[model samples]
Target: MGEPEAARAEAALTTYEDDKLKFKVQYPSDWTTSTGETPASEEILGGGARDLFTISPPGANARDVNVTIVATPAGADFTKMGSLGDAYGFGYGLVVPLNKPRAKKGQEDRIQFAELIDSVGKGDYYKVEYKFAKPSTGINSIFFVLAGLGYDGRVSHLYTATAQYPRAEEDKWRAQVEAIIDSVVYPPTIYG
Candidate 1:
């Protein structure tokens, strides 16, 4: 099916798919994915949390979108997500404030996630999330991101989605990252 227009008005709902084996999600139509590099408003850090990512199309009112993969040592504890910041050097505990932020009325879970993300970014930073789900391929991952807009009205994001697979399994996550990059629909490149 064609990309379903983004819903939530300001938050358009789009269509995409994923390789459940890699636990990776793709983007809507006209979108494309790239590897080993940042996409649009996205940036891939060189140290700390290794990651791969892509961002939303540079369009009117559209926010940046990315798919990153980071890693946590096996048996790491998620309960103290806040403390894990300085503990891990990935900015988790550094960004998230000890006191949680208030979410809009009637939005507890969403608000909670938002607060967590905000804290993890450590300021001007965007997001930090976690996902230890093991995929069908048996590859585990540590995932998170930081996102917001720069003064240019363009989305800005940093994310990591690292995989814990056999060294030989590198191709799997690489393929997943490509798929997400392929899904972006950014504005046409303009070279003045």
Candidate 2:
């Protein structure tokens, strides 16, 4: 990891505490926040993206838009995961230019530090979710994965969070989103 970083963000005008903060990063000021929940009908893997949730906070409708980071490993063979027999999933992705890699090996798992900056390259805010597709130990059985750029450069991770609100209510919460995501960073010590 180049720089160890963490962030606090809000999406879809909804709020949540540090219930389970796996990791955090600061985003640019332009990138918005997003939120969503896992569908009940979805299957359980390693706890990754299986749905796409979007919002403009809980009140406004422009500028600030929070996303549900629902991503899974591209290399994952759904068939390999097991029967895809009626499984539900959700996730979202943004086209971003990845910076130079600091790792000596491949760019895959080596991307220890990653985040979504602003459109103008400024530090913005973003909501992220890191789930490794496996069996969950929660009340229900869950399976999600954090696969990287498979043969194709699809989404590296699926950031799934809860923004359980409508588009028009995410006003004030929207303004603070970019700043939060922009602050995404990884601890340098951990990288070493």
Candidate 3:
């Protein structure tokens, strides 16, 4: 007989903690996640980053809405890393370049919105929202990246949520995605 299939993530909502990145975030149980260590030909999946986890809804493809968590190297300042404004700027600077190419033809306008939000126990995190249609498929999609520092103060974990669906269904999934972003909890940082 074949081995039993693994259980799916909870349908209601659940938390995911990355021991290596030292951060935690809540996601829908139905969404599936694949660790960065998953065997792949590329070292960095996107934005020259490492330690990533790709979260996707059932039967979704690359053009559909998905979420990715990435760990990035941090500078010496822990407080700055925790500050939402600073992190927002840092994150914006890092992602714009990577996303430029994905912008829709002629509409490659780089439009974005960002804000600072308070984390329950952690200091703060930056939330950014942006969107563009793929030039090839002409699929309009949106992405949200919640960025904050990890417990070690030496790394920043960015929770990137993305979605692409029919315009009529946007409201339903947009609210769902925002809720998931709000449920994030960062690991405790330890100073030397």
Candidate 4:
């Protein structure tokens, strides 16, 4: 038997390129794109991210359904960590503290589930799936993330792409979201 038609068919996709960062990715053709520096809230995390690229669904805000890529300098500490799991742990550690203070009233924002889905090229890249919930806001979002390490000649960097959407819409958007994350392409000359 052959692969399912749905799997074989490709969706309309548009490419987003960062000439300065030497990276590019393909997203849904109808999605909107934006670029900016890391927000101040993220600046405390190990000197902060160097750049951010966001892709949001048509007529939707990033908080609703989006894919975000954060590029940050991978210092000695990150290089020393040595594994995809460790990298993920390091990033998650930074996020938890930030979310703690934002929790509503008596409710806590927490990770309902997390899994290290896969890795490629001996830890050059990794994929993860996790569920986070803000009980007070009644929001349960599912996240699909891809993290990779690259060296941009002068410095090493970590590029993480996160795709998030409400859990209730998973059945409708999971495949497309996964496709977007999987389509990410880093500079061939920079990444090993």
Give the number of the best model, judged by TM-score: 4
TM-score, candidate number 3? 0.61
Which candidate gets the maximum lDDT versus the true structure? 4
After superposition, candidate 2 runs with Cα above 4 Å error: 1-21, 24-58, 62-64, 71-175, 184-192
**Cα-based TM-score, every candidate:** 0.26, 0.25, 0.61, 0.71
Q: List the lowest-lDDT window of 10 residues for candidate 3.
A: 113-122
Question: Per-residue lDDT of 33-80 in model 4, one digit per residue for the tens?
Answer: 888996545444447547888998886656868999888877645552
> Could you tell me the lDDT of residue 18 within candidate 2?
22
| Model 3, C-alpha of 51: deviation from truth (Å) | 0.3
Candidate 1: list runs displaced more than 4 Å. Answer: 1-21, 37-49, 58-92, 96-192
Q: Estimate, for each residue in 1-192, the C-alpha lDDT of model 2 and write its tens digit.
A: 443343232222323222233234333334445544554445564554354423233444433234333334333433221122111111223212222235465544434322232222111112333221111211111111221111113322323232222224345444354344333331111112
Put down candidate 3 lDDT per residue, 1-192, tens digits, no spaces: 654443333346768877676667677787788876433346454344456766667765634766666665544464445444554465566455654443456665543332222222224556666554444454565556666665544554333333334334577577766677666666544441
State the lDDT at 162 in candidate 4: 90
The stretch of ten residues in a row with the least summed lDDT in candidate 4 is 111-120
- Report the Cα RMSD per candidate: 17.7, 18.3, 8.2, 5.1
- Writing each residue's lDDT as its tens digit, candidate 1 over 1-192 gives 655554433143244322211223444444444444323334464333223443333331122233533222212232222323432354454334423345566654333221232224333323444433223234233334433211111211222332122224345443433444333322211110
Models ranked on lDDT = 4, 3, 1, 2
Global Cα lDDT for candidate 1? 0.33
Better of 3 and 4 by lDDT: 4
